[model samples]
Target: MTQTASMSQNGARGLVRGGALDVLRFVAALFIVLYHVAERAPVSLFALHPALSRGYLGTDFFLMLSGYVLARTYGERVLSGGVGTGEFLKRRMLRIWPAHLVMLVVFVAFVLGTAAIGLAPQNPQWFQWSQLLPQVFLVQAWFVPGISGWNMPTWTLSALIVCYAGFPAAWRLTAKVRSPWTTLAVGVAIFLAVDYAALAATGIPGHQLPLRFGLVRGIPLFVLGMLVARMPTTIPSRLADGLAIAAGLGVFALQALGRFDHASLALLSLLIYAAGASGAKGSAWASLAGRLSFSLFLTNQLVAVVWFGAQRAAAARFGFDATMLWLTWALALPACVAGAWLFERLVDTPLQAWIKRWSRREAAVPAPASEPIAA
Candidate 1:
């Protein structure tokens, strides 16, 4: 890294450590990979233990994380009315789309290769062209997921898109509310209550609303994150670190025990916002980890899933207890770190430049100081 970028990161090191929240983000992504990983194994490592059920909560942490960033980055923008819905979406799309397009193509290619080699399972049900098209669109979740298009974690991207779509409307409603705290409270209560009530009415078995492209399930959590960011005073560093640690344990422990009840999740969400409010002083690793976290979250699962497939094949071919699978996951950590680094460099770093250009084009840019005319 260049000295400037390094220093920028160093400055951020204190500011962005997600504390436990950041750790939870990376861990959440890894846990999702593990859930899939265990599923591909002869026996689930998680099933042997009761705590493995927490894999479903990755999206919950995501909601918390989203809330934090929204408040940190854009909370005030809502009232000031500078960032319009379209511009906000444009930035979001730029961040997500480039990699998403590549990832989508890669999956499609994998499916095709599997089919060509006769390795594709004859589930007739799992493989279909109709589903592939929409999966490419990242809109497949709007309909049912066919086995052929079964990218389980990609649903996060789809659901986030829904949340982004709803944010403008939600902002209007929340902004009109008299108090920021009241806005946050009503939003959280409405989502949880309405979601749970609807789940009860529909006889849905679990607390998570339908796992696909779901706005209703996510918006409240996003709002809570923003509320944390909007707090009048920055959280003290020492306290932030403590909450950061607590957030990680909270998510991990809940997941370990196979619990994500409304109460547990409510607590979890509070910790997430708190960590964000705390900001930089939390912990060293957390700040570093959180810095590249979004990149890590988006890319790690694909690597893990791809590695999982390769390991499954290699294991089947070589007759192993998925020993290679272990090796792949082991290797994947560094690979994921490296990928995140590159993504931060190529995709994320460009955000500032993009924002500058966007600002220049929309708002007036300060003129350069006139050069002294040399005689």
Candidate 2:
């Protein structure tokens, strides 16, 4: 095959670009936000009442996508000595932490400001200093359990950091496996075992493993995504595109039914595979939205709280009915979108550029002059 053909088939690599996966990222992030709307709403909307009830699964999709994209973008470089582990980690940290820290500070200020004004947060437990350590260090999901303390959605970032730390080793090990399919199968089995174990132990998956065991919840699927990345993307484009459609439908159907956890994951895997294999270039808007998705996901809790706070302050007279819930959701959704866009442009974009420039300067800096006496 020609080089261009190969590149198209394999999909673009790196965080800034991918093969239609950015669109998937946008969709997945939106799904989670809508899910949160249903959960936090005084009453759920008729339109969102069905599939969104299980929308927390969107985070599961994000975890897998992260693994897949990282492996595709950096795995070969790390394995081939093109990128050092230190640099790889530095880049990952630069990608996430600057934006994350900004949001963390904002979240903290919101809590403190509200408390000072005699308006204790509705979820005061998350505002405690106990969560500060984990949140600051991005280890909440690993060290702490149940909730992500300051920002509820950020636990995923904590778990992702863990995965990023381990990915070099994991990628190298999986590369040696004779059959990537077998590795994926084993991963799926392990995931099922853990899921069932959680189900049996708790009698319900309700806020059990996913909320508390971020490491356990994340690692297997992450490994599965890496394994998937190893497969040749030369599958016929038409077939892959068709499979993508089918997988999307399957995801919606399973979500609506709200049963069979593994099936949902399987469909997600198929979606990723199809997206990678179909040779579709992501649209500009999709790419921009995907880039903003991190901001969107991380800042949502704060925005929602701010919306509710405003409502309370205004004495808007909310009620336990669809109208009030929809109204709050409507206001909150736009705030999240605008906040995400602004955070991406003002905070994340500039900070990332500065970090990259700093890294380059550090690399360019001359080591201390060798001591003449030693020479």
lDDT of 1 by residue, 1-375 (tens): 001111121132222443555666766666665555555555666668766655556666677667666545554565578677777777676667666666566656777887797776433454467766665666654645444344445656665676777676666666676676776677567666766776777765233656543444555566666555444334565776687667657766765565556656666666665655454435667656666766776666556556666666776788765565566656656666677677667866676567558867865644557953211
> In model 2, which range of ten residues has the least summed lDDT?
1-10
Off by over 4 Å in 1: 1-22, 121-127, 143-150, 205-207, 231-235, 255-260, 279-288, 321-375
What are the per-residue Cα lDDT tens digits for candidate 2 across 1-375?
001223522354223353477888888887788777665565555355565566656888888888887887777677787776666777788788778888989988988888898988877777878778788888877847545577878778878787888888877787788887877777777777776776787665522365547777777777778777877776777888899999999988876776666778788988998887776654669668777788898788888789877766654553436566567567787788888898888888888889879978986766667733211
lDDT against the true structure, each candidate: 0.60, 0.74
The TM-scores, one per candidate, come to: 0.76, 0.88
Minimum summed lDDT over a 10-residue window in model 1 is located at 1-10
Candidate 1: Cα lDDT at 70: 59
